[model samples]
Target: MPHFHFHSVRLVKALLACAMLLASYAGAAEKLANVTILATGGTIAGSGASSTTTVGYTAATVGVERLIAAVPELAKVAQVKGEQVFQIASENMSDAYWLTLAKRVNVLLAQPDVDGIVITHGTDTLEETAYFLNLTVKSKKPVVLVGAMRPGTALSADGPINLYNAVLLAASQDAVGKGVLVAMNDQIHGARDVSKTNTSTPDSFKTPELGMLGYIQGNKPYFYHVSTRKHTADTEFDVSKIDTLPQVDIVYGYANVNPVALNALVAAGAKGIIHAGVGDGSLAAKVTPSLTAARKQGVLIVRASRVGQGIVARNGEANDDELDFVAADTLNPQKARILLMLALTRTSDSKQIQRMFYSY
Candidate 1:
């Protein structure tokens, strides 16, 4: 009877150990982050006739499902799910699409199960979209925008690796509240400062003045800096109820510049104008009258430099107060347009808009 009782006790102990092992495995699986890839077609989804063809290829040819399938390694980092938000090259990305994407991101981030988001975009206008989302998204959840310079069908296509690194960034806890990020070539840049510096190349995206925020190594995200500007939930711009963005146009400033372009933009019902000036956002003496006249006609004018880097200081080079114009500060013309669009939704006051430029 004693021998039989001892064996029964040992059997019970073995069963308990087996149950604990299964529970441990289940816990580890549940700890994986739930990451969603919002694919808006770009060169990342592009294809070509030959693997060597990088240019003149058809973009947005692949879908999100195929993109995810190509990178099975993504499954190791997070529970990734793909959703096709739009199937157009990012150059064709419109204000309506921006609204749609922002709304969708907000909705997805609200879900308790979704930990972060990765957006696949075209390099052409990825910075614009990323900056737009930085100012408007209402959640602190990490939003990482990624794009490839070479088509996915290229011999050494960079899309898969970029996509994988982006997912890793989104799944990172350190990415939270860091505003929107642009991850490419294993480097992470703040959306507010990053720009497409090269026409075509895998290392095109750069933040000239502020530098990169972080980088990804071995599928792990290492952050070095945090953006000081307001963003995400801390930003005042909200796109939840916004239906349409205001009409803002960009005018290039060059030698022998004429007022016809500026006048034409105003004639075409442009609510705001961004003068991409030659140096320090300076307006040529020849074009100042037109800009002054436009501002007098209730049109908002902002001065941004064509020189890529440096700030267009208020009251520094131009008499922004006297002309009733706003300087673009450190923001490029493209990003300035995005801020002006959202600022117009709140108020058309130049003071308020200038304040918005400084803060955002």
Candidate 2:
């Protein structure tokens, strides 16, 4: 009966091992971070006619819940919950939407259970929205923006993998206080520096001059750089009480540009106008008269370069100090418009506005 006792001891040891395995898994599950995905429909939610179709597809066809289901691996990384914030393409993103989104993000980040947030957006205007949130979001919690160049129905769909990496980045403690980030094509970019450079490729978003903040490898984010400019929780811009953003418009500069466009925008009650100047943010002689007139009318004028990568040095091409114009340092025209809108809400003094441009 010694043999029976020996077999029973082995059985008991096996049961104890099983229990330990189960306990370890339970501990890991409990440690998972709680991440909420705020989905604003874009190509990531678009669906084509067939798996091979990429272009000419219907965008915003899928909802947040469906997008979440498409990426089952997201569950392994975090306790992810999806919210259908808006079902329109990012190109249709409006200032009203920005206010609503910023408010909602502020509210959610205030909760104790929320560890981070991931926003699904369209590549077209993703940089603009990311920058806006970078300025407005009050909390230090990680906020990530992600998008796909191809529709989800394509044979080599990239949405699912991109979503997985974004969730991973958001859940990481290292991502906190780094400002809002854009994760696409396995690259992590700070909102202020990144812009969509390509039309249809997955590697569209890039910070060509400053380079990416980091990159995602093996489902983890590794940092090499962080934006030194003020962002998130540090900026003076607040959207909590703001109902509507001020009217800010952009004008392109070219050889012998007509001044009528500048005059028309001022007549339309634009609070701020960004001249997308040519070469070092130069003000053409033809449009200078109109700009001077607009400035006298209490309109804020900012000169931003049309070049993809370069700084619009203050008082370089034009006498910013004398002309009372603000230069957009290292900001593209589209992003310049965003900062000008927020700056107008606080003050219109050219000096103060220029300070905001440099600080943000």
Candidate 3:
């Protein structure tokens, strides 16, 4: 009887071991790639009085450690960890901040242990940072930038899901070489072309000229195309040596536009000025004097359209050739501002800046 009991015990152990092996195989198939989360304080880390307010929340409510604990399920997707770099509002970010952020990303991306990186930033300036990363970091592995318009404590906080999807994409092999991406409101947008169109809506981000690159479903990401922006390891644009970016101001065009602001910026040591022209990027009559005077002062001039879409061309309108301003092709005013600052870092020649506008 004792021998019979021992044999039965051996059979039970064998059956249990086989079941465990099968379960492990199935679990490994759906498992995600390794990804890292670098948290810079933003709405994603914010909290409200209750689960009712979103935009009205304060950003200092949660730290990186708590954020990780708040979402324990993240461990199931990746070997996730968070580091608190900064806890400031995104609108207050500066060129120096951009430099620091870029350097950090570069270091993490170079690490063999880190397969991917996710930056948690504020929605106010998330696109700009994304574009900056899109320009600077050179990694074949996926780098995703995500933000929340609503705080995590809000009734419909969008941070958790956005972070999840962004991290998912970051770890996915398919997302490699796709450049930097911004995942928000279930949509995946390319970094260079994406913009925040609405302040209150959950589905606020949009690529003016380009559609979404992909979408998230049930925590899984699907990609349709790759980002073709000239960036990291591909381009010569560097952010480290940029101590003081050239001052570039925007002059908006109205029915009766004035150049007083333009001329003042020039007088105040503005290195560059972007004139937000009227229809099809036509300079306002009042702005012509200031723009011409700016030209005489050796200040770099850029012409961008007030309208959100399309390209800008110089010498298109009558009396435009005499102005001699760089035309912002397909680049919006703010983007043109960034390019102008970057271009001025290397050369102050109008021809060279114009060439950059065309090429970049």
TM-score for each prediction?
Answer: 0.95, 0.94, 0.88
RMSD of each: 2.0, 2.6, 4.0
Instruction: Supply the global lDDT for candidate 3.
Output: 0.80
Model 2 ranges with Cα > 4 A deviation: 1-24
* Inter-residue clash pairs, candidate 3: none
Candidate 1 lDDT over 175-285, as tens digits, reads 999999999999999999999999888899999788999889977889899888999999887888889988999999999999999999999999999999999999999
Rank by TM-score, highest first.
1, 2, 3
Clashing residue pairs in all predictions, respectively, total: 0, 0, 0
TM-score, predicted candidate 2 vs. hidden true structure: 0.94
Candidate 2's displacement at residue 209, Å, is: 0.8
lDDT (Cα, tens digit) per residue for candidate 2, span 146-207 = 99999999998889999999999999999999999999999999999999999887888899
Q: Which lDDT value does model 1 have at 49?
A: 89
Total backbone clashes of candidate 2, pairs 3 or more residues apart or in separate chains = 0
